[model samples]
Target chain A: MDVLLTSTAEAFRLLFSGNPEIWEIVGISFRVSSMAILAAVPPALVIAFTLAYGSFPGRRFLISLFNTFLSVPAVVIGLTLFIILSRQGPMGDFKLLFTQTAMGLGQFFLCLPILVCMAHVSLQAADRAAWETARTLGANRLRAFFTVLYEIRFGLTAALLAGYGRIISEVGASMMLGGNIAHYTRNIPTAIALETSKGAFAEGIALGIVLLFLAFVLNSLLQYVQGKGSINP
Target chain B: MIENFRIGFREISKSFGSNQVLEQTAISIASHDCIVITGNNGAGKTTLLRIIAGLEKPGHCEISLDDASPEPWRRLRKRLLKSVMYLHQQPYMFAGSLLRNIEYAARLNPALADRESSVQKAVSWAGLEGLESQSAASLSGGQKQRVALTRARLCHPQVLLLDEPTANLDSESRERTLQMLREFRDSGTAIVIVTHDPGVFSDLATSKLHLQDHRIQADDIGAADVVELDSVRQSKKR
Candidate 1:
């Protein structure tokens, strides 16, 4: 208990003193997560919309498949991508393993199912009238698609936040794929892992605090979007 | 003079599982025709209009516009979509300013030399002028209906399918909407309205179609009702 209290106090000082090392890890975490989420949203939206509105033979199966992917273990994703990008593996010539790009790629996959699942739910819950209304208003398919997207913007926003929240706190994929290389690919979650393992509780606690703050902000944004949806309706 | 064209639907049938909504229904509507489609709930009056508008496909249905080849309808839905407009019972308000909604429809009509002016004219015609700056989603039910009508008018569709258009409007809004419909008819657009409110449109109808038990209960009114209805309209105008 004494050690925990001392670590907590030291953690605050490290955070407030603007420690350069801590700031770099935080920055890399944001950069990778942001890029991965940006990469994930467009494809996720297209797939979700297709699953929601399309009547093709495999649509139900495809939706179920994505939902199944939503619960897939992040460590399993990391293992798969690590193998693919490793020195002895296929495409090894690119030497992407143990790099930030590989970490982002892993995070991209990690975030995709969350985005696709939530976006699909949003699209499914959207009013059919919006699509038909845009169609009969002489909007071409593309325009009608955008109009439908606008109708469910709240759900999309929540999906984005969910994806960001997942990627930001995820330690397994980032640690395995990124190798947590110092001054390069180390991120908040991995730093917490390393610090705790080394018995440097202050650093670990500090990183955990940052992660918790991030999660709080994302959840708050999601709540705001949900409130907006209800009030507008 | 407005060119006369016919909207034809042949043997259109649609079903969800074993529950058939529309079955092998045939309708041929001519220009300037004002059709009042009446039925109890779930009678598929709206479905018939949707099939004609090409927004929906019957399990097996076909449409031919006037003497035009079926190829045109098959090949150019995006380009020719302007020829048909459908108004929902509760009009959908897109997430934008009302003026943007009107402008979006107006952009589709290539014949409109000036989109802004035409949108303004449509807003005035539909009595939706001052509401232009407001978010359409915030409008009352009557205002939304008017905005929908304004969009349909701006598109200048030869055929307008209205699904229970006056279902929730006050008398004044209904009268205003009816007057707008009269003007559209005068300008040679065919109007097909699906409604349960016969009293609201009994005097304005050129033809009445009654749907019952998933079939055409009655089509093309008897001559006597048409004559009486016309005289009633004439008397009201005077």
Candidate 2:
């Protein structure tokens, strides 16, 4: 308990001191995760809307496929992406292995199923009248789609936050794909792992605190949005 | 001013699973026409209106416009949607302010020379001026209906399909809604209303139809006949 308390106190000191190295890792984590989620949202929303509103053969099969992927192990994702991005693989010609782009790609795939599943649930729960009203009001199909999307903006925002949370803190995919290089590919989770393994408890605890702080902020934002969405006044 | 418009749908049928809601339904609508359709619950009155609005796809359907060749409903659905506005039984108010909902429709209408002025005019026309800044979804059912009418006014659709536009409204609100529908009809908009209480719309309906057993039966009553019937019903109530 004493050691833990001391480490936590030292962690705060390091955070407040604005240590360059620790902040760099934080920046990299945010940059990569933000890019990944940004790249994933549009396609995820389209797929989710399709699954919710579209009538087509194999729709149930596709939904089930995505639901199944929700529980896939992050390490497995890393391994599969690793194999595909390695030399002699089909995509290996891109020379993307051990790069931030590769890490972002892994994170994109990691969060896509979550985004799709959550957004699908939201779209299903939304009133179909929104789409019909927009169309009947002279909106084209694309405009109607966006109008419905705006109607369910709260749900889409929550899905995005959840996806961002999942990818930002995930260790296996980031560790494997990024190679955890200092200054370039190092991120919070990878830095924490390396620091703790090297007995640098203060650094690890500091980064852990950052992650916890982020989780708290994100969860608070989610709750606020949900509350706003549910209450009419 | 609205131009001459005619829409006719024939052989329209819709089924969910094994239950058929509408079968071989045919209806014709023309500019300045007010058609009040009455029916029992589950009688497919709403389905017929939705098919006319192009919001629902009938299993088999054909459509004809004014002086144009008859075409399959699927081919002309986009055009049908452009000219038709369908209001739900409980009108859905979008998530923003009432003015925003009106502005949304006004923005889509290219004929509205100035969107802001048009929205303002619609707000005043609907008596929704004081409520423009209020959240649409927070309004009462009657207020939401008014907001929907305001939007429809901005869009200026040639055909207005209403599903129970006065289902849950106070008498005063119902009268206001009828007044608005009267204005739309006077402007040559084809108004199709599905209602259980057709008496409330007697003054506005040019013709009455009944939906029974998955088919529409046209009644020969003219507007004057409906108005007389409504007075009789009112006198009986007194």
Candidate 3:
């Protein structure tokens, strides 16, 4: 307990002192994860909307496929991406292995199912009249789609936060794809893993604290948006 | 001041798996026309209107415009959707304020040069004077109906299709809605209303049609005869 308390206190000191190394890891984590989510959101929303509103054969199979992917272990995703991005594999020609781009790609695939499933649920819950009303009001197909999306903006925001949280905190994919190189590819989860394995608990704890803080901020924003959506005021 | 326009949908049919909703339903609409359609529950009145508004894909349908050759519904659906508007039984107010809902419609309409003033005028015309900033979803049913009409007015659709526009309104609200419909018809917008209570629309309906057994039985009474019939019905009610 004494050691834990001392390490936690030291972690705070390191955080507040603005240590360049620790902050660099934090920045890389955010940059990679932000790019991943930004790349994933549009396609995820389109897939979710199509699943919710489109009438086509195999749609049920596609939805079930996504739902199944929602539970896939992160390490499995890392291994699969590692194989594909490594030399002697189909996409190895891109030379993307052990790079931040590769890490972002892994994170993008990891969060896509999450965003699609959650957005699909939200779209299903929205009123059908919202789409019809927009069309009748002279909006084209794309405009009507956006109008419905705005109607369910709060729910979609929650989905986005959830997807970001999952990808940002995930360790296996980032570790395997990024190789955790210092100053270039090392991120929060990977750094925490390396630090703790080396018995450097203070750095690990500090990084852990950042993840926890992010989770708190994201969940708080989600709850506030949900309250605004459900409550009249 | 509106240009002469007419739409005729012929050989319209729709089926939901084993249940046939509408079959070979036909209707003709023109500018300055008010068509009130009445039918029993599950008689496909709303389905027919939706088919005309291009909101639903019929089994097979053809559309004719202003004495032109009839074409497949698919070919003319885009034009129909642009010019036609359909209102729900319980009108849906969008997420924002009443004024925002009106403004959304006005923004889509190219004819409205000044969207803000047009929306304001529509709000006042719908008798929704003070509820501009209030969330539209919080409005009463009658208020939602009026907001839907106000949006329709702002868009200036060539055909306005309404499904049970006054289903749950009080007498005063019902009278207000009927008055608005009369004004829409007078402005040369083709109005098509599907309702269970056709008597309420007696004054506004240029033609009364009944939906029965997957077909529209149109009662093509002359304008003077319809006025006389309305007076007799009103006197009988009193």
* lDDT winner: 3
Q: Native contacts recovered by candidate 1, as a share?
A: 0.82
- Cα lDDT of candidate 3 equals 0.90
Residue runs of model 1 more than 4 Å from their true location after superposition: A87-90, B1-3, B69-80, B107-111, B212-238
Tens-place lDDT per residue, model 1, B1-238, is 2468776665668887898998766666666778788888888888778777777766776566676644333444543355788888889887779998888788867888988888888888887768889988889888888888888888778888999989888998899889888888888888889988877876677777777777665445443332124433334335
Encode model 3's per-residue lDDT on A142-178: one tens digit a residue. Answer: 9999999999999899999999999999999999999
- Per-candidate Cα RMSD to the true structure, in Å, reads 3.9, 4.4, 3.8
Off by over 4 Å in 3: B219-238
Candidate ranking under TM-score, highest first, comes to 3, 2, 1
Grade the docking of candidate 2: medium
DockQ of 1: 0.61
Q: Tens-digit lDDT track for model 2 on A75-113?
A: 899999999999977899999988999999999999999
Model 1, A129-174: lDDT tens digits are 8898788877888888988998899999999999999889999999
Ranking by lDDT: 3, 2, 1
Best DockQ goes to which candidate?
Answer: 3
Q: Where does candidate 2 stray beyond 4 Å?
A: B221-238
Superior by TM-score: candidate 1 or candidate 2: 2
Residue B55's lDDT within candidate 2 is 87
* CA lDDT, candidate 3, residue B204: 82
